[model samples]
Target: MEITTLASTWPAALTDPSGRRQLKPRTKGRTMVIDKGIGLHAFTDLLATSGEYIDIIKFGFGTSPLYPLPVLKNKIELAANQGITVIPGGTLLEAAVRLDMVPGFFRQVLALGFTGVEVSDGTINLSRGLRNDLIKDAKSLGLTVFTEYGKKLFGSRIDVDDFANTAEQDWSCGAELVTVEARESGKGVGLFDERGDCRDDDLSHIRSVIPNLSRVLWEAPLKEQQVSLIKTLGPDVHLGNIPVHDVITLESMRRGLRSDTFELQQVPFLEYMI
Candidate 1:
C-alpha cells in the first residue's frame, strides 16, 4: 500500500491533537514501538508512514539473535537513517547477563548498527551494583541505555519506593530513561492488572511518590492505558510498548485527534504543557 504524506495543511492536531508534545527530536513524551519480527518490507512501510511520530523502536525480546546478521543490520540502518533509534529489547539484555555475555551483546549491538540498548532484569534477579555497572558500561560505549523497572511475572506488583529508588540510580548512572516493565502482552504484570488495565490507584500513587515522572517510561501497550495515562499525566508523559500498527494512532490520541480525546479540541496546546 502507498503511504500518505503528512502535508503541513492537515491542521496540527486534526489527527493527533496533542500538539503540545515536542515532536521529532524531543526527549519527553517519546513514543516507542515494539518490533515483533515484522519483515523488512513492512518495517520500511511502517517507518515511511509513521516515522515522524516515532522516537524509538525495540526489537522485542531475544529476536535480535533470531534475525540473520545482514537482515538485522539492514533493519537497524534503515530505522536509524529515518532518525528513529533501534534498540534491543531489555529481555535480551537479561539473557546476555544470564549467559555472562553482556560484553558480547554490547559489541554485537553496535556492530549491527543498533543505536540503543535496554538494560533490564524483568525476568532475572539483578543487584543494584551490577545494574549500575551495566548502565555505565553501555553509556561509555555510546549506547543509549534505557533501563527497566519491575518484574515480568504475572501479578507482579510495584512498590513506589523501590521503583523510585531504581529510577534514581539508573538516571544517576547515565541511563537515558527507565522503563516501567510491562511484558509485550501488557497483561498481569507491572502496572497493569489481570485484565490489562492501567490500575489508576497504583499509577496515581506511583506518580505521587516518584520525584521524576519524566525519567520513567510507563509501559502502556493498551489503548485505554495510553488514553488514561495521557489524560492523567497530560499529553507529554513518556509511554512505551506501543504496537507498531498503532504508532500513528497513538500519536493521534496524544494530539487529541481521536474521538476519545476530541472533546479537549478547543484547549490551546500551551495549556497542556507543564
Candidate 2:
C-alpha cells in the first residue's frame, strides 16, 4: 500500500484515543527531546520518524559544542525544516556566563543556526538581574528563549514561592517557557524524590501556583514520571528531556494508545475491547 493510503486506513480514534492536540506549532502539549550525543544518522531517523511529535530539540548539557560545525549545522537545519525549535543545552550558556563570554556564546549560537537558546543556572549561581538579562539578550537576537527553574543539586527541590517568582520574571523578560529541572535520571532533583517518584503534594502546590500549566515544561525522562505527569496533569502537559528512542512511546502515552494511558479515553471496557 502507498504510505498516504496506509495512513488513511488507520482509524483516528485508535491512533489518538485521548483527543490530544495532534498538530505541531503547538503552544501546549509540546515535547522537547534531549540529545546527549546521538550520531547524525540516528538523529536523522528520529526526525524522519517522529518529528511531528516533537516541538523542541535540546542538545543536552553542552553537547552542541562537541559536534563538528558542519554536523551541528546540518542537525539544526533538519530540525528547523521540520518546524522544530533547536537549542544548545543550558549548561553551555552557564559556562559562558561563568567565563564572561556571553557575547561570544550568543554569536556562535546564532552562527550555528540554533533557532532558540536556553538560559539556565542549573550548576551556577545566577542572580535575578543576570537571569533576566540573559533572557532579554536571547530575545533581542530573535531567538526563542527557554529559561529553567530550580537547581541541579542532587537533593534539590522546588520551593513553590521561588518557582512562581522565577517563572513570572522569566515570562516578563520574554521567555516563551520555563522548564523544571528533573535531570536525565529523573531522580533526586526538582519535583522527583530520590526514588524517581513525583512528589504529589509538591506537584499539586506547584500546579496551584501556575494557572497556565503550559508555561512550565516538566522534564520527565523516565516512563513512570511521564505516566505520573500525564495522569496528574492530563494528556496535554508539556514534557521535556525525553530520550530519543522513547519519542514514539511517549507519543503513545500522550495519545492514550498505550496501556498506561488507555483509560484516558474513558471508553467502556467492552467497547474498547471490541
Candidate 3:
C-alpha cells in the first residue's frame, strides 16, 4: 500500500495562514503526538494528513512493548521516513529501571529503530546521578533523550528552582529537551490544575529560571490549554501529548489557521511602514 503527504498535494503559501511558521527540520514550534494504541492504518492516516507538522510521536506510557513487533516496527519506520522522531514514553524507561532491565530496554529500543528515548522518574524515585547517567547512556547509544520533570501523581506541580536545576543538568548531560508531565488527560498534574486550567504562575516561574523556553515541551492535550499556551508562548511553543485525531486541528491552530490564533501573527506596525 502507498500513502501521500499533504505537502505533496498542497501549495505552501495557500496552506499556512501565518507565513512565518517554520518548516520541519525546525527547532521551535514542534508538535508531538501521543500514540496510545491507534492501529497501523490510523497511524498512516495521521502521517498522510499532517506528517509535515508533527515533530515527534511518543508511544505512550509503556505501550510501546504492547504492540506486535511488525506493527511497532512499521510505525517507527513510517514516522522516521516522514522526518518524525519516534520514541517510547518515559514511563517505559522507569519501568525498566524498576525491573533492573535498563540495558535490555536500550538494546531493544535501538534494535527496533527508535530514534529517541524519554528518561523520566514520574513514578519511580531516581537519584540525580542515576538520571544523568541514563541521559548519558542514551546519548552514547546515539538516541536523542527527552527528560521529564515533575511527578505523574495528581496534584503534583512544578517546583521552578528544582526544575531549572534538573533541566540544566539534563541538557548538560545531552537531553534534547525536558517535558513537563501533564499525562494523557491534561488534568490534575504538573502544569494543570484540578479543573484542567494552567497554573500560570508556575509556568511564569519556570520560564523565569529556564533561559530557553524552546527546550520545554508542555504536555497539553486539550484545545483550551493549547490555545492558552500558544497565546502565552506565541505560536512556537513545543507541545506534546496531542490526541491522534487532533493533529490537523492542532497544526491549524499553530499556523494561525484557526480562529483562536487567526490574528496572532499580524504585526499591525509592519503594515504601516513609513
Candidate 4:
C-alpha cells in the first residue's frame, strides 16, 4: 500500500501582526537607515534579528573616521556577507570634500570593504559641476552611488523646479536614486510642514517634471511621514532615513497591512493578471 504524506505548516497566529511581503534585495522599495553610531555588539544583535528587513546600512556622518579600524572592518564584512550594501553617510563625504580628502576617504572605504557611497550637499555647497564630478569619481571606485537633495535646515523648503533639475543632473551622472533630505527628523524639512505633514503640492510639482518618479526616495524618519507618503504615492514609493526598528512597520504600511493604508486597499477593482 502507498501512503501520501503532507508537510506540516502552521498558519500565522492571531497574536502576530498583519501580512506583508518581504522585499527582495536591491529593491526599489528601499529603507535606508541613518546609523549615527552602533557599536559592534549592538550592530550584530540588530543584524541577527532584522538583517533581512534592511537594504542599506550607512555609517552616519564621519563617525566612520572615529571607529577602531578593526571594528569598522568587521562590521562592513558582516553586512556585506549578508548582501547588504554598506556605505558611509553623505555627511562623511561632505567632510572629505571639506578636507580635500575625497580620494583618501574612498581609498580607506575600499581598503576596509564598503560597497556603496552617498553624494550629497546637505551640509555643504557642492555646485552642479563639482557634484557631477563627485558622482563620476564614486562610480569609478565601483561603489553604488546615491545622491541626496534639499538642505538640512529648519525651514529649508524645497523649490520643485530646483529639485527636479538637480535630480535629473544627479541621475545623468549615474546615481541610483536621489534622496530627499529630512536629516534624521521628518519635521520642518523637505516635503514636511512644521507638524511633519507631507506637502501634496510639492509632490505634484516634482512629478510633473521627474518622469521616473520611482527613482526619488523620500527620507521619512518618522512613522507618520512614512504612512503619509505611502498613502499619497502608493505602496511602491521608495523611502529613506527609516529607523531600524520601524523597517517592518514601514513595510507593513507600504503593503496596506497597517491602519494607515487600509483605505488604499480599496482601489478601483481590476481583473487579475492571471
Predicted model with the maximum lDDT: 2
Q: What is the model-wide C-alpha lDDT for candidate 2?
A: 0.92
Residue 205 displacement (Å), model 1? 1.5
Q: Over 4 Å off in model 4, which ranges?
A: 1-22, 263-274
Q: In model 3, where do residues sit more than 4 Å from their true spots?
A: 1-13, 267-274
Give lDDT tens digits, candidate 4, residues 73-107. 99999988888889999988999999999889889
TM per candidate = 0.91, 0.94, 0.92, 0.87
Q: Write the per-residue lDDT of candidate 2 for residues 222-252, one digit (tens) a residue.
A: 9999999999998889999999999999999
| lDDT per model vs. reference | 0.86, 0.92, 0.91, 0.82
Candidate 3 is scored at a TM of 0.92
Ranking by TM-score: 2, 3, 1, 4
The candidate 2 region of ten consecutive residues with least summed lDDT is: 1-10
Span of ten consecutive residues with least summed lDDT in model 1: 10-19
Task: Give the candidate number with the greatest TM-score.
Answer: 2
Write out the backbone clash pairs for model 1. Answer: 16-252, 16-255, 17-255, 17-256, 17-257, 18-254, 18-255, 18-256
Q: Runs in model 2 with CA error above 4 Å?
A: 1-9, 266-274
The TM-score between candidate 2 and the true structure equals: 0.94
Clashing pairs in 4: none
Q: Which of the two candidates, 1 or 2, achieves a greater lDDT against the reference?
A: 2
lDDT of 3 by residue, 1-274 (tens): 7756555557665477577678888898899999999999999999998898899999999999999999999999999999999999999999999999999999999999999999999999999999989999999999988999989999898888998889889999999989999999989999899989999998888777875798989999999999999989988899999998998898888878888998764434546558
